[model samples]
Target chain A: MKRFLVVGSRDLTEYVNGKYVPLVVEELRAKGHDVTLFLIENGVIAARDGSKAGKVLNGLSDKGARVYAEDVSCRARGVQTLASGISFSNLDFLADSIAEGFDNIVWY
Target chain B: MGKTEPPGSKKKKTQKVAIILSTGSYQREAPTTVLRLAEKLLERDIEVNVFAFEEAVTLTNRDQIEHNEPPSLRKVLGDRHVYVGKFVDQLLRVGLHGAKMDWVTCVLCAQERGVENHQIGGSIVGTLGDLWKFVRGADHVIAIPTYR
Candidate 1:
């Protein structure tokens, strides 16, 4: 199975790019690829407990795709509690993922 | 005695600056800042090249202006060098046109946006390779991301 990492930079419901990420991840996973969703910048909202995007991301996580929020981004935005299933990560992970040869890296 | 520099030893070099703008027209803030910067650079005799992409391409649509005013791109960019990526066909009412401005749109971006033969007169259809030529030849490149 191909490995995929999708990076987002805006709240999932705030822009077209944000809203499209989960859909793209689901599609890739449905096609039998392993997918990981990483939210950064304002996109950290996707991991907030009560946000609309957070719920959607939780559903995607339950379906098998892994979801994460950048730790620095969350701290800056005061996002203390992440939505269920979303984990905190860092840029180091992103660099390592690239080095580990992810088949596809999508940034939005 | 301290070291004495020779006369005419260090001639002033003309700075070549390039700006890539990705915000659309309506936002106003980012584009205004870009034009102001370009104007400031021109005042200091710096060579400026501007490339507009995504929604920023709307700046080339002359008819979309709400009203004419100072600091507006049309007023400020007069006789200046400007370019827009062709993917703009999706949002533009018309393409760049004017006697004083030099404007070109990326051909591939335009075709991808289904803008074949549809842009207003005066804008040249170019390619990304051409854009890269400017970027590579320039001394400094500035990118203004989309804000809205």
Candidate 2:
């Protein structure tokens, strides 16, 4: 049960529409590993309230997965705030990820 | 900073900064992280490269498959960047074609997507070795994984 970061950036539907994220996170957590998410740029956009990605993200959050975004990336892309799913983070989170020795998983 | 420097230098120090687009759907805007990071690295005169392989190669297709973000990855890769795409044509359908990755060594990904060694895109059938080299040579390898 190691900590892992599953980056969900592109396809909102898979997780948002299809519930892929909830299923995977549920299974991973069921297995006893801590799971988190870092949605950035367009990824962060998915987090917007009322967005499909947002709904999906909300579901994952309900299940105990901590979610975040790269603040710097968000700023560069003009994303002022992250939506329903999670909070925004500074690049320091990237360091936190490395410091904590979390495995990175990807979802586009 | 010979791989022993403190990690906090990320903001102050420059990095070689090469990223593997992998081209899979998982990358999304993050895949462009390669381009974003590359631009930053290039500002400091560091080198940046985009390597594509595996099902990741499927990324080049810009057809806007249902329920995706706007400005497909190909649109993002267009801004003065260098990337290698296996099944490069698949990416081209999305309007991505600058430097096809021919200079690097290619090996068969255990799953094998290309046809007779080639997939729909006339890509140089590739493998994990290609990925390993990118990881070994570059400062860091960020994978933008996609799921169907």
lDDT against the true structure, per candidate, is: 0.61, 0.51
lDDT of 1 at B123: 50
Where does candidate 2 stray beyond 4 Å?
Answer: A14-18, A72-81, B1-19, B23-31, B35-130, B133-141, B146-148
Which regions of candidate 1 are displaced past 4 Å?
B1-127, B130-148
> Each prediction's DockQ?
0.02, 0.10
- Judged by whole-model lDDT over C-alpha atoms, candidate 2 comes out at 0.51
Deviation in Å, model 2, residue B46 alpha carbon: 14
**lDDT, residue A68, model 2:** 75
Expressed as tens digits, the lDDT of each residue in A10-104 for candidate 1 is 66777665677889988988998888887877778778899887889998898898888877778878998888878887655544454343555
Query: What is the iRMS for every candidate structure?
Result: 20.0, 10.1
C-alpha DockQ for predicted model 2: 0.10
Q: Write the per-residue lDDT of candidate 2 for residues B11-87, one digit (tens) a residue.
A: 33323333555445454454455444443334444444455555455544334234433456647655333332322
Model 1 CA lDDT for position A56? 92
